[model samples]
Target chain A: MFKGKKIIVFGDRDGVPGPAIAACMKAAGAEVVLTVTECFV
Target chain B: MYDPVIKACSHVLIHTPSFVRYGSKPSREIDDSTTPVLPAIETHLRSFEEAVEYPPNQVFIGNLHPDRLNGIEQPWYRHPVEDASRYGAYGEIMPEEEFLGLMKLADDFDLMWIEKESAPMIKKSLQAHPFWNNSDLGKIDAAVEMARIHDKIENQGSLPLYCHGRIVGCMHRHHEKDDALKAQVLMENLMAKASGALALTHLLKKSDIRADEIDLLLNCSEEAVGDRYNRGGGGLAKAIGEMCGCVSATGCDIKAFCVGPIYALVHAAGLVKSGLFNKVVVVGGGSMAKLGMKFKGHLAKGMPILEDVLGGLAFLVTGDDGESPSIRMDSIGKHDIGSGSSQQNIMESLVLKPLDRMGKKITDVDRYAVELQNPEVTVPAGSGNVPLTNYRMIGALAVLRREMNREGIDRFVLEHGMPGFSPTQGHIPAAVPFLGHAIDAIKRGEMNNAMFVARGSLFLGRMTQLSDGLSFLIEKNPGRKAPN
Candidate 1:
């Protein structure tokens, strides 16, 4: 469903991290330009 | 800058055939008049050799990896590991006598009393064990006379302790009339603590972390340790920590039936990430009440009882080392109160929802660790292959999500699923059993990521009709911080 999409992700250490979202998006044919996983707390 | 990684895990087992009669179902049947006594139980009890040689038990103690079970012949009990040792890479398989001595060592108020004749055997065994010394064995009191022990059992309500079908010791009642403080319950609680302490001690050794450095301890065993004033109001964590010399650690019990360990793991991770503790340890002891839970079925099938051992496990969670696999805190999935209780609904909530949030599909996870109850123990009881059932369900979900067609489900499962290898200790089998292997495999670069999923039946407590579940992912550490 994410085919041909350009995505940027901000992930949380306590929730979902950015690399995981990037992996998912990439699996769905998206181009992930940036990914960051932060501790929001 | 705080990230928690699983540093090490240790799995230990105690072969306690004598305790099988004390398990919930067996005791209930014993007390009831309608059902006949299980005639085949005593004859069917596996010996120490069989217990150590059993494939699943070997897997539980880390003598053999779970993947090795695939190549071994089915009806795994028939094909024993050649020259299996009492100790494994992760932990040891302790015999009943040493565990009895351990029960005495774990006892503070002199509740457990070993017969005078058997004292030397226990003392020598404990003395030779890798983890203990003479000073620790000093906690074992001089043996009680057979007359006094018989008195305690005959009229004082003490539970008899056995080894090799002999009366080796007895546990005295804590209170005269309180059922919660009775000898039987106390025995169960002590077994949990003693076995749990062994696992914790091993975890300290495996992780190269000192006992006092364990700043927090979590007791996730299913045993309830409390007095009559508050049955199940317990302090297993501190009890276990005290036995293991985790002097700086004080903690409490967490209960969610089979899902207790996973809940404790998440809590431990949170504690470490929040800087509440530098190192947190989660330990679960084997349930004496779960022993021989499926003995009747095994007996009916003319097979030896497979549920003869008590399983214990411990995991160390510390600030990320930039080498060990890091728990994906962001990818945690929980079963909500509103989530439907159907198989598909539960899978979607626990398996797919977290993956969806992470922008991944079912195929992305290298492996999925779920209920790992040994199929040999469960199959005869009509419970089916639990872990495989979970894998197929996830595969089915992939089909539903259009990740693959229906025919590809088997291929998906084969690539991502592992055979069930955990002992049938209720909480012991629920996904967490794979932690030790997961850490090793990821570090060895054999796999990228694995998801641990735990499901509990809330109805077992009779509080509600709802089912419960939780999941989290563990992947190879990226070894870099995210940009602010």
Candidate 2:
């Protein structure tokens, strides 16, 4: 139900559904942005 | 009148506690995809409902009866692991479905999915709660087709989320490598963060202090928030801070086995005194790894796994308002490398020396907060009442020092000691647990001074044979009598 909601995640890579969850949320219209993990911070 | 002291104390819960829950340790039946839901396990879990609602919880945060925990019979050997509310209080137990919804809200992506069957249940749960009134779930298209969910489970959704033996949801892996963010690790980390964040927000509300007022945040939970290169490095502080709406705040993680919160308190107090920050919060989340940490002993006695709840604490130490309790900065205790590891030596170094330097006696402090783990949770598992043991030790010390005769030890304990009420979440149950109650006592002038003492095993990391501890005193504000 996150339509139009802006969201940010800390760790979002393989093994963690963070990216997938973010991608799904984005597909559902939430504005997904930012990752604070090692490579992406 | 504003001394560097605690202004308020608050505690919150996630409620969806389980003794044998978590993704990392899956059973043979749940080890991989393609398995049907494990009905037996869920049934076993649900049977525990009765244990969680016991007299302790409601009065616990002191909602209804304040003396329930004090009145309950000791050595509740009737059961193992489960607290009295074996089934977790309805007020606290946020049913599995509801918890998934929370996990979703905290999720920035559509990576979380509940079966079409479970989605409605989650929705109903979310709609019923005040905490979810402003949620965006209704705005999102949440129900996932089983076929689609199955595909995700088979291909990318390797990390599964189970509720009541059903494939309710799955956490996916975004990488092809083995060392990447594993679904197992993700689930564990997310569970801790979500729970901790919820507790933190609840504390902010309980204290009626705006989150933005917090200048710093610290996550003393056992979870690590990092990536491959720095797998063990952490930043849960910043993540939880942002979630708590500490907009201008920046935070870092602190770890020292179980003594973290005490160390964090000393550091925060120093920060407030140093003029680097005005208001600081030291918060910790419960851990999944610690869930059912004592399952074997509990099960040996046919009791449900009791390590159900993930307990957490949040307290604010700001410029003392002269009326609130001030932290005694004059003689805080710290265990040095030379501090011997024996019980007597440790106690002397940790409890006595510091107080002596401050010209205080063992009996001077009105109350002492140490390992207050609930006896009910520990006794059934063969571990005796921890807090009482600590108090008895102190009483013994008092006797040796000629402060009290052996006969007076019991009286001293009865007057100064308290039953353990905290969950056995190691660090979570340490001295920090009594903070809320201590704040209440000081405000009512029932206690003039309370010393919080905590010890941690350095042997866990295999780096040192030494034990570590720190002690700090909080006392009734002397009004204009002192500047802390």
Candidate 3:
């Protein structure tokens, strides 16, 4: 739905849904840049 | 004005039996009500699933489950997923068979069923998906059996799990059923995870967005996730992201009881507006604790069990485009720690103060979406109508503010408030559901501004007596492009 929209995403490694937010942004075709403070995995 | 606009929102529902017995409140509600209806209405979820609307914007999931009233399908009946009019912006009500497949995908989250038993069952049970490879599952079965067999025998309690009328596997209680870290809790948590993943998947699918494009994810549900040492809520966002192909995503969990979604929305909006992030998504998985929550009430009412659904929502807030409704940052409402707990106090802070700050009246908002639990589901349970109660409070606030006369309160409510259409899934009925409708209405010139109000009971956690609330306005696009 967000076609051609310039969407920059930010996520936290600490939160449960942060990576979901980041990955969804990318999947939505947003130009994403993920910043992981710490990797939980 | 705010930089972040609601790019899209998708709602998804799934019917699973996990909530029927394991959900504490629902199980208790069933036991407490004299006329408990067990197994009689298990098929009702499938029937009701046919009626709920998909995306353009829909409100009520409607409590009329035909199968409960007449044990078979009527010639006129059509499932929501099949019908074009019934489905909402988010997605259609996924059938039970598909949802069972998802539970398998989410199994690694401390959930395990007997492989020799469930494996063959799942082969026939699970719907087709990329993750449903029997070969891949064989590896998990081999590894899990060696470890799980040690816990399956004498001391552990094994509860056989069922799905779509077939035995899936025995859910061995590694500890007591009440043990928060073991069987029951683990099942509930994993169901929520799978449900959330399904929603996120649909949201991405409906929005035509790519999973890898997601930058930030926030899980607003209050699910606890951890090992034996530290049982807590964490990393669900990333796990869901990974499940949906969001390889580059990072995430966090936001906990505020029912108000968590609103908090996540505000935080996401701020990040987008502040140029810290552009595409921000907020998602809340369905609550296992809430499923079958009012089954007994529905049974007494001779209606279908309406609480069998798992509610999941995913929405993207991004820098504004000329077409989408944008979030108004300046008028955001918050109930501070010192804010006294009272109906008037909450209404004042959430409704009037924000409007006052925005230099608008109570009547300025075209509609208010708050705690919109369907009366059909709640009234039978003696919970009364939650959305109606909320509307009355707002109408009473309007009367107090002299926005309208007390005598016209009903009329005001009729005009400004909507009938409760959401399932009683706590946070699912909160403000977020309205975003889909408000966006549609605004685009159609039906309304210039709409407010999304959410309130959470902090007292539920026993940590505080204060009630939490969050409110924000979504206005017409203003027909302007965002500046670089």
Candidate 4:
């Protein structure tokens, strides 16, 4: 699915799969776009 | 949107032998004598009780059949598995031996201990009670039959087992009972279940976390609570939080029918990603109305009884530390109607698009575990594609990769995804089944990533709403270095 798409993950502060997803997506040929952590105010 | 990065993950499975086994038909047939009983319920219960480490003091019975369940058409047909077993050839009551074999299979898949003693209490209390007397002593008869099955297993040198979670609460609905009395009993049951879960939370506090550390509480169940005016988020959540000593907690319900656990995981992941909660407790109580709905089918086919047991489950979803991969909440996908209405579109919106956005391909995942319910329970409806929703989603991922097309999606799914291996219970298919296996794979360095997808049918109400949700697991490659 990640042929040429740019990947991004919007996550809760404690959400999982942050680094692993990024690395896997990168390996699958998608450019790692950004990993933003959604902080609760 | 943020770039997805996974730190660590852990999946744990609590096995119980308390699964129920009864003949399909109410009448005993010659073939029924040949069916072997599997002592799944007994073995699991015994394991829980004998465990040297964590003995469950609280148990949550998720779905049980009160001698009678109210407000349903042909209460016997209420449980799909029971219907399939009685009317269709596909539904087979898991004989005691087969039931134990399934539990053993779970062990092969990495489930820990099974819970034991609870079933005896259930068998003793309700089976022979006047409330369940209508089935011609069917309820108690089934319980006694299952106990006999357990005896056979014990004679074979199998260890008695129980699941790890304590019996905190229970919910029972008798169609014939007074509404007020039923409500009172249900409330007490809920409180007990919540208290049991809370006690576990306290135990957790003494282990690696503290009471104050828990940030979110999730109550997962099929029961839709609230007055006709306001129905959602049952009292179990707040009550559980209060009983467990969690100071800041609000309960929310995740209803995906049986896939509530996966949805709960995804929701918990979102809360964690949003910095809203550090520690989230996801809990589910049991439903008794779901029991023994398939006896006729089972009896006709000479298969074991289909509805044998009802129980609840709970888990602690937290931030991944250095030792485990985090939930990777940022990569989740939702099924909005805008994603398209066809099966293809639904799959794309729920699975493909999210992964594409994450820049991951289908082949990169070691295994795709979605809708892992055992087919014996769901196949009688001629719904051959019961788990096909998940398979189709995975196929869409393959199609997105240009490796397959509409016609090939089915084959692609068969090749990539695991079989439907969960029980017919509501939350069994929820990502819980894959949690332990996924974590173990990552730890063993055998796989680098896996996908956990769960879907729901919000349309069952015919409100024009679509039921859908998706979550994937990206395991850490041991060969890769940490990004500093």
Candidate 5:
């Protein structure tokens, strides 16, 4: 569904990390521009 | 100097394979069913010798430092050390019988009772340890008859204590019917106190500091020690302190689930930094709830249950002595309530923001200690490798910030991350286990800084959906003069 799409991944340290999400994006034929992992208390 | 430094640390383990059947997960399996027993679970338990030789357990107790783990083969269970000792440089892997004696020594009320036959052996073992004194040895009582123990187990709904498949003692209930004060819960609390005291005693010996020198003690274990009226009312800190002759140390408990140690470390550091206390010790005992948490997987995979040991650790935080590393209080990071719960968000606050403020990058940290649950125990349970996942996440964050090329992400992990060696105990694996190795590496000038990151699953409490996390840096001491 993300084919030909450009994505910016925002991840959590405990949940899905940015790289894992970015990998998923790549797997889905999406271009990843940037990723950031923010801490949530 | 008012800086908070980790003067010394000690890590201990209790080989409580018998107690594994009583863990929350297994216990529930008994209570919720009619069988009241776990079929063939006891057969899979490893003996003390096996526990001592286990590579990860050796790392936990400092017989083998964490850095040495790289040389050891994967599936460490298959590669046991030759002629390993229970006594380690940092602490000891106590036998179940000795730990029970300790539980008796720690008990103030008549909650725990031991069989008379096992008392003498226990006394001899306890006296052989360098940490205890005659006064401490006087506390263990082994005169209780087996009939009383059997009665407690069969009639009073007490929990049976075991060693080598035999009933060695029983823990009695506090109230006739209070579920919160039942023998099982009380036993869990007492185990925490005893294991914690053992670690503290080792800390006193390792640090070469008097127990009375401590001004405050913080209990950061997973057990809740209290009566039914106040179910979670806690004083394990003082209870454990008293057990180890910390007569002058006052204490209380701190709870944030698995992130509790980091939270306690920060609070202890803050207390020392504020000059309110000169010495603060943070301790975490093993969790009964976590033992045998993944036994089904281990049994299915035809491997010995690795979650059979109880872990305990202690750290002494005091003013910088111009030698030991100091905790970088200036770079503390916390997951604010509004930070939002996402992998990206938690990492941003814990790993990025703190380093960002100090003009540092992800690669700057010599090492990162996060959820370090051993892969052997976790992977078979399908939990994946927790520490490896955290390192990858951090590497990903580095890539996101352009601090490193995406192609070098795996290399970053290899350089900065370590293999997980801690047990699957709830709080034990949450980043604090690396403190001992980190301290040594910094003193040896092998590394300059290590960051400890801890994240808690607050949602498990059903209190809120909010997640919790805390991070802090420990770096080589930058000398500062003490006030005259």
Candidate 6:
């Protein structure tokens, strides 16, 4: 799944991809797009 | 705001039967109310010594197998075999026939079983899902098809029947005999204990390093600290320090999941650059609770079990000396929140930005080692993608460098990257692939610089999650003077 999709957005709730998921998505060509960290008010 | 440097590094070590010698008994816990299970930390440390063939003087930094819990064989999550019983309640115990069938299928198709328990879960889930209810034959047929495809891709070998079978059987029992939520909790707890202990013990064994010498520690694993019911705490850092006799050790957890080790390395490098700490250890423990997950999925797909190993890994990073392969601490790339970028933008920020800052092209580097795991492990999970995420990252980097485009990137990765090599352990996919080879390549003076990258997902908490990462370059003998 890491090919030709010029634009990809990877977002999770707490803003981390556990090593396995990150590696897999990167390998699949997602570029690790964006990481949105939660801010506690 | 941190730069990481690698002064001296150690060879990557692996351990098997890590907690076997601990025996099937619970150790005392700091809290009398909640007893923690002891993981095979000592056994694995001993095995790690053998795997890397390190001399006794090498200082090791890692975690300790918590001495807690009654080594009772909890029906849903007990080791099926006696020898595998020491690592906690979930080292070995899978269904033999089902596991064998999955291995045979993996061998026939070249697939790597990622998680040993995946097969069984798939089977149960599929059986209960509406999709499978429509046509039972279709579901089994789909599983078989997936298994065959996985085998072809991962280059399967003979199955480790006994260990894997026991694991599978235990998992099956967990689901069949216990409540689903309770089973999940128990499984998670066991996995956390095993991963924590393995990584911690392995860290302590490093003679070339010491806990007091390390200013930071990073624990990367698929199992996170928090669950649906509670916030998280009690990671490997503190536990490891206590085990290693370094009571003052301070550290945090880094999650990019499989890519966690790389992230930990980068984080350590950054800390060193910031002058916050002189030494740091990036470590991960094996997930015994996750054993047989892949096999369970395969069984669902009419295949045998494919998982064969259980272990953890650790790396040490120190202030860079101009002479050693230093991790270029300043050359860090990040996908800023405002970078209105697509996937390519994300790739560019995370991969290209750092290279651009360093004025280096992808081809300029000697050999690119990205996610290096055996595909045979993950394919049967219906994850058709090749397991080497790093190779793909390298290929993506090449594309951004104008060497190739999207299609070309795919072709290049397929051509250059190592295929399906790592067991389907969660953190195995991270930069662990390069640890062994990178050290050798640097020692042999074959490569001047290598990149380590790790990424993780934080969405499992049901919050709006995004991927975060860290990257740095390891160079050969930069020749800088040692720190005073």
Better of 1 and 6 by DockQ: 6
What fraction of correct interface contacts does each candidate retain? 0.00, 0.00, 0.00, 0.00, 0.21, 0.07
Q: What's the TM for model 2?
A: 0.81
Off by over 4 Å in 1: A1-41, B33-39, B481-484
TM-score of each candidate structure, all chains considered together: 0.90, 0.81, 0.78, 0.55, 0.91, 0.56
Candidate 4 clash total?
Answer: 107
DockQ of each: 0.02, 0.01, 0.01, 0.02, 0.13, 0.07
Error of 4 at B80 (Å): 24
What is the descending lDDT order?
5, 1, 3, 2, 4, 6
Ranking by TM-score: 5, 1, 2, 3, 6, 4
Tens digit of per-residue lDDT, candidate 4, span B1-484: 2212232222112222232221122113223555532332222232322211111111011121111122223322233322121001111111222223222221211111222334444333333433222323222122223354355334532223322233311222322334432332343233224323423342353346665666777776556555434454366565556655677667766666665777776777677656677677776654433333344444444443433433344566665544454555546767675653345565666667767777877766666776654444444422243465557656766776696677888666655565554444555456555554455557667666777776655544556434455666656633333342
lDDT of 5 by residue, B1-484 (tens): 5468999998999999989989887778766866535765777889889999999999888788776788988778889988888888778899887788788888889798877777777777777665554555665654588888888789988888888888877888989978889988998898899899889988998887998889899999998888778888999999989888788999999999889999999999999988889899999888887898888788889899999989999999988788889998877889998776556777889989999887888889999998888888988977677788888989999999898888998898888998889988878888989999899989999999999998887766767556778999999987667663
CAPRI-style docking class of model 2 based on DockQ: incorrect
Per-residue lDDT tens digits of candidate 3, residues B1-484?
3457888887777766544665666566456767654555564443433434321113432222211212223222222324444344556565555565566667763455644555554554443443344424442243234245445633576544666565545455554534656766776677778878877876786675688788989888758876566677387888788778787678888888788889999999998888877677788888887777776676666665667677888888888778888898886998876555445665788888989998999988888888767666777776676666678888888899888899988887778887665777778888677677677778889889889888876655656445578999999888775566
Candidate 4's docking class is incorrect
Model 3: per-residue Cα lDDT at residue B368: 85
The CAPRI quality class of candidate 5 comes to incorrect
Pitting candidate 1 against candidate 5, the one with the higher DockQ is 5
lDDT by residue (A1-41, candidate 2, tens digit) is: 68888888543211122444455667888887753321100
Better of 4 and 5 by DockQ: 5
DockQ of 5: 0.13
Tens-place lDDT per residue, model 6, B422-460, is 445657555454554555467578767766654443343
Give the number of the best model, judged by lDDT. 5
Q: How close is candidate 3 to the true structure, as a TM-score?
A: 0.78
Between candidates 3 and 4, the one scoring higher on TM-score is: 3
Return the top candidate by TM-score.
Answer: 5
- Pick out the ten consecutive residues of candidate 1 chain B with the lowest summed lDDT: B458-467
The clash count of every prediction, one per candidate, is 3, 36, 54, 107, 17, 117
